[model samples]
Target: MEKFTTLTGVAAPLPIVNVDTDMIIPKQFLKTIKRTGLGASLFYEQRFNEDGSENEDFILNKPAYRNAKILVAGDNFGCGSSREHAPWALQDFGITCVISTSFADIFYNNCFKNGILPIVVSPEELEKLMDDASRGSNATLTVDLEAEEIRGPDGGRIPFKIDAFRRHCLLNGLDDIGLTMQKSEAIQGYEGRMSENRPWV
Candidate 1:
């Protein structure tokens, strides 16, 4: 996981709601446990046609949004099956944040774990960001985790709430494994004492 202190990047507008795990990673691409390559297949069914060609109509295929690091989507984003791969693909595709009116609980939690900021705000605020994102490459948004705000290109700032613990983890780049590693010395000492006291084992 990477440290996510602040990000200022292109914001792609995805107006669709209920973007499920299947549309995100797809079933066929689930065979591999790796996370990197999935970016190419993100939104597999919607991004590419049956002939494996880019679907020009999709927001991601547009030239301006091809390098989008953020997405402004409709309500109920990331609904459906509980697949961690959804966040993996989003992160792999360089999306550091997703702003929506609402998001599925599981997917929202998963975003924090994967270094992605899933922001939920009022529908009015979301629409404003969506409008800003419609301006193509100029749809620049600044997400400052420390400030807990999303700044738009039109000089508007919207505040968002995030768990303090999750904010700490993302700021320092600490995942579950990274959290455990913080106590490595204590763990090593415990193991040494156990070995010394129980030689037979």
Candidate 2:
């Protein structure tokens, strides 16, 4: 996982609510367990037609949002199945942060593990951000994790709250395995003592 201190880039507006994991990567693309290639298939169903051609109508296919680093979506984003691949696909698609009024619990936590920031904001605040993102190529937003603030293109600032421990982990690039590694010495010592005291086993 990568450290997520701050980010500044274009934000794609996705106002669809109840965006489930399947809608994100689709079931066909889940054949591979690897994370990198999924970006090309992110939102596969919506992004492509039955003939396997690009859909010009989808928000992501638009030239301005093709490289968007942040997403401003509608309420209850990432709902449905608890798939870790949802965040993986988002990260692979170059989305470092997602701002929505609310998110599914499992998907929200998975985002943090995969080095993606999932932000929960008020409905009124989301409207403001969505309006900013509607500017297409000019929809640049800045997210400062340390400061817990989001700055819009016109210099409007919004504050958000997150769990202190999750904030620390994201700042330092610590995942579950990374957290366990922090106590390696203690684990080693315990193993050594067990071996010495139980020689027969």
Highest TM-score: give the candidate number. 1
- TM-score: model 1 vs. ground truth: 0.97
What ranges in model 1 sit over 4 Å off? none
lDDT by residue for model 1 (1-201), tens: 899999999999999888888888898888888878889989989998999999999999999999999999988999999989999999999998999989999999999989999998998999899999999997699999999999989889999988999999999999899999999999999999989999788
Candidate 1: deviation at residue 83, Å?
A: 1.1
* Highest-lDDT candidate: 2
In candidate 1, position 18 carries an lDDT of: 86
Error of 2 at 180 (Å): 0.6
Residues 66-160, model 2: lDDT tens digits: 99999999899999988888899999999989999999999999998989999999999999999999999876899999999999999999999
Per-candidate TM equals: 0.97, 0.96
Q: Against the unseen true structure, what C-alpha lDDT does each candidate score?
A: 0.92, 0.93
